[model samples]
Target chain A: MARWEPDAQARLQNAALELVARQGFERTTAAEIAEAVGLNRRTFFRHFPDKRDVFFAGQDQIEADLVAGVTGAPPGESPMGLVGLALARAADTFAHLPREQARARQAIIDAEPALLERERQKFAVLARSVGDAMRERGVADLEATLAAESGVLVFKTAFTQWLADGESRSLPLIIAETMAALRALYVTR
Target chain B: MARWEPDAQARLQNAALELVARQGFERTTAAEIAEAVGLNRRTFFRHFPDKRDVFFAGQDQIEADLVAGVTGAPPGESPMGLVGLALARAADTFAHLPREQARARQAIIDAEPALLERERQKFAVLARSVGDAMRERGVADLEATLAAESGVLVFKTAFTQWLADGESRSLPLIIAETMAALRALYVTR
Candidate 1:
């Protein structure tokens, strides 16, 4: 009898990120990743096109959720307010994944130049998509663009810290804190 | 008699970026870049260890100018306000570069993934140094990090639009406008 785990994709992703973190990303092989998780090479390929995709598996859903958060925010908030609320929702969604898993993914990304580039490209894509989503919310051009870029940067900074060792704050809370610190800029002006 | 152009470094940088833009960045070699500028390989190596460094020619000066802008700001300004002013000054310093040259530099950076990563790394370095400079100015930990990161994102977004074809706004003007839009988040709160 075959004992199948329902979360095959996640298990593979965790194994791959861990393997890449333990060894240099360049030295890790697909077969090795599959072997680490007791999955066949074919099954691994079915889940991920390549090793890098393992780390960014939920990318599309993340963008969609982020966009939905922006476009579907409660009315009457300022553009940046709506964007901040949107980012908070986005952080909550990410909070589901274990912090250690995120850190494992980040460790590989931080160590490899090529993976770092891929992460940069993902952020660039996120900014463009988030900007467009805000535009769909009827926000002005420059306003939407600025808020989108700021939200992504805040998310980036907070997410990095949220996964730090001994850290226990929720992603949304960290993001709110970061945004509040930023807002202090205008009050003191 | 050889005619000497004093700005060989600038000429080399221009040649390298253009070459990378025209040909794919990976296909362009250092020898080709030197040949394009009529310099010997040894001369090229003297200026930059490799091809990637050419796109980041102003690395040291940009960091110094940005840090100086933060450290030397007139007292009685909010940390974020000081950062905005410092970013404005940094924008001014960059504005001295010809628009056409900056556009050419950006074109290759935009087109190549590897160059984009190198650019990202440069910005990360800029943010860290800017944060340290703010720390030295007596700003709080989270506040300094957020401001520095925000300053870089603002710079990135403005610099991108500043060099767009048919656009003629000064870098500082674009930066100022971007900051104003961001500051509205606090003002309207």
Candidate 2:
């Protein structure tokens, strides 16, 4: 076997999600997932630190994109506007994922307490990163934190809508609409 | 020993916080906490499901109070207004706790990953409860969720300020100010 296989990470992730969704996260093992994809457990460990991490493969890239979005936002954008750009960047990532795969991954996460906790921690870290990025743009400390959290809240809302059964809207459209709704909450009578 | 002792829960909570703060969350056992307060481990379990539960003793009451605040809010109140009332109700609960104990409990939670996960879970549940309460008040589902999450965000920001060194504002006051700040983000230029 070649030392490096093409798209090993994606293959492993698909296998892991399929197996875990079918047999349940607790019942599935890392070795079993790797074997399903014709890779050894050592290779699996090389891609992900643990079984839980397989479910969150693109987390680092998502965080980096969010930070870059904030850092490279157009000048004179409000804190909330910077968050909007960051969320759009995240939407781009989610848009590339097949809806069925994303739905299956969400189901696995929703059913497992450990996975849910990891998701929460990931969101917390992402919010902190976004907040720090806002600070670099000269947004006040408290405002940065507020904007970051609100952005995550909007992302969560928009993502849920996108994942809803029979919901046909694009992720970016849902994000823009959700952001508008959030702003409307304060602006309208 | 009497089957029921007055203030047993409060005493156990105090002991648990002191022990957990001094020795750390993982090292402090339910048995040690009970013994410190002159109670048995069984009695401790009666009040709390586990050691982790000690740090979240009033969670149920806080949930109930928030729901009650939302349900009993004035007619014609906006969803966000109801969230404000619920947050104020929660602030009232925090105001009664000794600041020193609150600070110590926070320190313990901050240092422990398990506790932080539990804290995140608690907040998630609290947000759900608040959202349901809004539903009962005829708020739309999406708006209810957004308001509930945004309210929790304000509580978190205000709570952090309340716990900051040398800061002395009451929780309710801080909560109000944080809410204002959140509104300002969407309203101001």
Best by lDDT: 2
Tens-digit lDDT track of model 1 for B63-94: 88888889889876677876776787788788
Which prediction has the highest DockQ against the true structure? 2
For residues B1-189, write the lDDT of model 2, one tens digit per residue: 677698999999899888987888888889999999789899999988877989897788888888988998999998778888898888887787678878888998899999999999999998999998898878998888888999889988898888899988898998999998888998874
DockQ, 0 to 1 scale, candidate 2: 0.72
CA-lDDT, candidates in order: 0.81, 0.88
lDDT digits (tens) for residues A120-157 of candidate 1: 77887998899998888788887888888878877888
lDDT of 2 by residue, A19-73 (tens): 9878999999999999998999999999999889999977888889889889989
Candidate number achieving the greatest TM-score relative to the actual structure: 2
Distance from true location, Cα of A73 in model 2, Å: 1.2
Q: Return the lDDT, model 1, position A188.
A: 76
DockQ of each: 0.58, 0.72
